[model samples]
Target: MTQTSATPLPPPEERRRLREAASLTQAQVAAQVGASRETVRAWENGRTTPRGHRKEAYAQLLSSLAAQTAAQEAVGEAEVTWRQQSTRPLTPAQAFDALYAFCAPALVRQTYLLTGRRELARESVERAFQFAWQRWPEVARDRDPAGWVRATAYDFALSPWHRFRPRYRHPEPPPADASDRALLDVLLKLPPPQRRALLLYDGVGLDLPETAAESEASTPATARRLLHARAAVADRLPALSDPTELHRRLAELASAERLRAAKPPTVRDSSERRARFWTRAAIAFTVTLIGTTALTLRTAPTRYEPPVPPGQTVLGVPPKVAPGPLSEREVELRRKLREETASGPVRLVPETR
Candidate 1:
């Protein structure tokens, strides 16, 4: 009966947060709840909720873990809890801000390496965060929100559209250090996919499978990219042959420059404003289209009317004759008459005078 009792679960996002805070994997939680990993994933993604006894088990597990996290935080002990705020219930805004603060700076730096431009790097990360804010519920419940944002940032930073923009047509200035410059040039030289794979694998310390997943490439393809990228770098800069050294150099290269990300509040505000603008624009367009359609239907001709043919002149109609030179006979006659009929003409001339 107790197992059958009604036990309301936390919101999907919070449930995920609680699980993540406890450092338990989705498979682990699913095992406890007697469900598959995908089922738990669906539950956390808000696609589906557990039923009957499973619901209570899932709820109780999250509640207990949350309590344990709170207790751990209460005492003065530095441990791997939520990276920013304590696991106590967090407002969405608070959680979002905490996540941004923890992840944005480092992500910006990583993005800067991915694209050799400070401005593009900063913009990419901010844009990615903006997207995350728009889909906060989905992103918050995601197993790795930071990775989600990172993937988004990579997509934006590596987009071919940027190349067409006048502002981003040319590459930004390279780093001052010779090694950093060479490394960046080499990175820029790599294909976008390869570049992304290398950054995820070597620079961000993601394992091969994780890197492949993030890159959206097959495992074999990702491995080839990583190998080719590493070979390219090793060829150009023998000093960075080691993967650990490459990571260190990448970090140093990114940190040596000043790449600042916008604050979370600003990013959120911008995203909200942009979303509202697009929504209003869409509404306006729909109204305009509907009105135009209505007007067209009301005023449009109901029946077909053939167009009148262009005017054509009648073939039988005569054109007026224009005077031309007189005939030779008539000219001779006129000259003879003028000479023979001089008496009447002379009288007339005297009367006129």
Candidate 2:
């Protein structure tokens, strides 16, 4: 960087980017540049200025790092893994396998960090990959398939609805380390938006703009959420106030856990199976709808039928009088009729005639 006319070093953020892109830790840069790690950090953060030989050495290291980063970009570190399947014509399965192999393990770990549940993490990554495979055509055409899958996994892992599921209703066990448990507790306490912003920026190494785009917010709003998340974490764990330190801690926390993703072939097969199941379900639903529609069309009345009229109240009619107590003459006649014999008086006279 200082070779021709002593050009000035790049900006602080650029310096940090170069170092990280080269995968060199601050201590490694410090060792190479003959300075303390703190000094290297300060230089990268723009907190302090380097001088003389150290400054020139830092510049040289940065130059090397930039070259290294550029070389990797040209050659493509991850592209090498899929060079055969992605570059050459290959079966969709092979391409999917390649992608699954490349992104699954890290995705699982990242999900684990997001949810603090190992089983849930694995499930989320698998579900994300399944969704990708189910829509492989779209995913293949995507600019960054890994990014697409990562967003899916994050959405699943951090979903509020998971709390309603029987499996995810209760809290998962805390990390074995007290500090880790504390940090995780603090992290989960943040609103999902803030948590997601923090993870995408600090944990995932995305630039602020990319993070904002992933978070689907304006740049300023994303910055505010990120700052708020960092402030919350810093309040709980004062040591993690530094973004770099938070990144390191997040990486450490994820790496310390034994997260294992399903094999690529298994994921592919499962995705295929899931796709088939849903397709069959959709077909069944469509057939049922068609049958029901046909039955209704055949059985339904051709014209509108007026409803039967309800019963009406009857009009006034004769009010029959109930019988009352008998008069004395009527009573005497009923007594004589009862006293007389059955066929005596009138029947005998008709027989003689």
Q: After superposition, how far is residue 139 of candidate 1 from its true place, in Å?
A: 0.5
Indicate the TM-score of model 2: 0.62
Off by over 4 Å in 2: 1-86, 302-353
Candidate 1 least-lDDT 10 residues: 76-85
lDDT of 2 at 310: 100
TM-score of 1: 0.63
TM-score of each: 0.63, 0.62
Per-residue lDDT tens digits of candidate 1, residues 1-353?
66535656889999888888889999999999899999999999999988878888888888798889889777535554444446578888988999999999999999988888889989999999999999999999999999999999999998888888899987677777887788899999999888999999889999999999998889999999999999999999998999989999988888898878898999999999989999999999999999999999999999999999999978987899998899999999888778766565565443533
lDDT of 1: 0.89
What is the C-alpha lDDT profile of model 2 across 205-303, one tens digit per residue? Answer: 999999988778999999999999999999999999999999999998888888899888888889889889989999999999999999999999999
